[model samples]
Target: MIDRDALQGHLQQLLEADRFKDYGPNGLQVEGKREIHKVVTGVTASLALIDAAIAAGADAIVVHHGLFWRGQDGRVTGWMKQRLAQLIRHDINLFAYHLPLDAHATLGNNAQWGQQLGLVADARFGDQDLGFIGPVPDGLDLPRLSELVKRKLGRAPVVVPGDGRPLKRAAWCSGGAQGYFEGAIAAGVDVFLTGEISEPQAHYARETGVAFLACGHHASERYGVQAVGRHLEVNLGLQHAFLDIDNPA
Candidate 1:
């Protein structure tokens, strides 16, 4: 078992949480038991996940997305109250790492996603270097790449076809990062993949000849937290469980 503050400090240093300006605070967001033995990790800390952690006899809950965010109503009412009450009542610690989890070189959502899809990341781009760029296998076109993504992620991607060009290089940023499409295009990649797509990206793809693929947001980011959980289990001698609550978006 590890002290809650120690665990949080280790993670903060490991992920370099201070490097980026993120949407919300990184590291421990809620205080619970001081000694954390068994941890439950997930993509998001929804109420369902909190209940599952409680049922699993977890001492701590670590996630990519935590309950609190910037600009949210300060009042903890409704769902927020329900989640916080459960954690507090159970004495389960709550920890969240947002951009840091996404940007970690070896244990990040983008890195894990790229590795799972068999893509070798050679460069990083976009804000805080969250985007990755690399080459696909030879003879792989947009259609073939889309099929590969579906096979690996277990969800078919929404595709915006390019000018029928042979795909040479690809770039990606997981989880609602269609905003990085233009940046990927600027990086000279033939295709850009992200968790979600907006209407304008289709037009941009059509005009720029760079294909666009919208892999499911949840599906794309299912690996990093699992990776971290395994890291803790193997290296820190802590019991860890990654519970994935199904999310189609």
Candidate 2:
């Protein structure tokens, strides 16, 4: 068992959470039990995840996406009330990491996704260096790379074909990062992958001859929190569980 503040401090230091101006608070969004023993990690801290954690007898819940966000209604009511009440009743510590979880060199969402796809990252780009540029395997074309992504991520990505060239290099930023497509193009990658795609991205891909792949936002970001959970188990001697509430988006 570890003190809740100590756990939060360790994670803050580990992920360098304070360095990024994220959309929401990065650590300890809600305070509960003072001592955290078994930790439940998930991509989001929805009501379902909280119930599951409660069922699992968790003392703390860690997630990539927490309940609170910037520009959200400050009042705690409705679904938010339900989630907060449950956590409070159960005395479960709630911890969350946002951009930090995405940008961490080793235990980040982008890094884990790249590792899963066997892509070796050689450079970083985009806002806060969240984007990764890497080389694709020899002679790997857009179609083949799409298939690889589908197989690994368990969802068929929406592909916008480029100039039908064999992809030499690829760049990616997970979770609704289609905004970085142009930056990836500027970085001279043959293909750009992200969690979501907008209408303009298709036109950009067609014009620039840089392939675009829209992997599911949730699918792309599922690994980082799990990686952190395992890290806690190994390095901090804390019991951890990753309860995935399936999200198709």
Candidate 3:
């Protein structure tokens, strides 16, 4: 068992959560048991995930997406109230690490995802250093790279092929970061991969001759939380389990 404060402090230091200005608060979002023995990690703190964690007898939940975004309504009501009620009633702590989780040098969303797809991440540039620029392994063209992405991520990414050329340098930012494609293009990457695509990204890819791939946001982000959970089990000696809820988007 570990003290909640101790766990939070360790996580804050491990993730360097204070370095980035994220939309939602990092670390403990709600107070729960003072001591924790088991943790459940997931991509988001949705009602289903919360219910699953409570059912699994978790003392705390570690998630990539937490509540209380900067622009969201401040009042607790509706779905927010229901979610909070479950946590408070069960006395389960909610720990969320957003941009910090994504930007970590290792065990981060971008790093993990890039590694899984065989991309060697050499640099981080773009907003808050959340974007990763790297080189796709040689001999992997656009078609082959798309194939690898779909097979590894278990979702067919929407590919906007550019120039029909072999992809070399690539940049990726997991989860709803299509806006950073311009930055990737400026970085001279042959392709940009992110979760969630906007209408304008298609045009940007075509105009700039940079390929675009929209892998599922949830699919892309599912790794960092799990990696952190595994690290917790090893580093903190806490029991950890990753709860994956399917999200088609």
lDDT by residue for model 3 (132-235), tens: 98888889988888889899999899999977766879999999999999989899999999999999999999998999999989999999998999999998
lDDT of 1 by residue, 78-127 (tens): 99999999999999999999999998999999999999877889999999
TM-score to native of every candidate shown: 0.98, 0.98, 0.98
Worst window of 10 by summed lDDT in candidate 3: 161-170
Q: Model 2: residues >4 Å from true position, as ranges?
A: none
Candidate 1 accuracy as lDDT:
0.92
Q: What residue runs in model 1 are displaced by over 4 Å at the alpha carbon?
A: none
List, residue by residue over 47-145, the lDDT tens digit for candidate 2: 999999999999999999899899997998899999999999999999999999999999999999999888879999998999999999886777778
Per-residue lDDT, model 1, residue 173, is: 92
Indicate the residue-level lDDT of 209 in model 1: 94
Judging by lDDT against the true structure, name the best candidate. Answer: 2
RMSD of each: 0.9, 0.9, 0.8
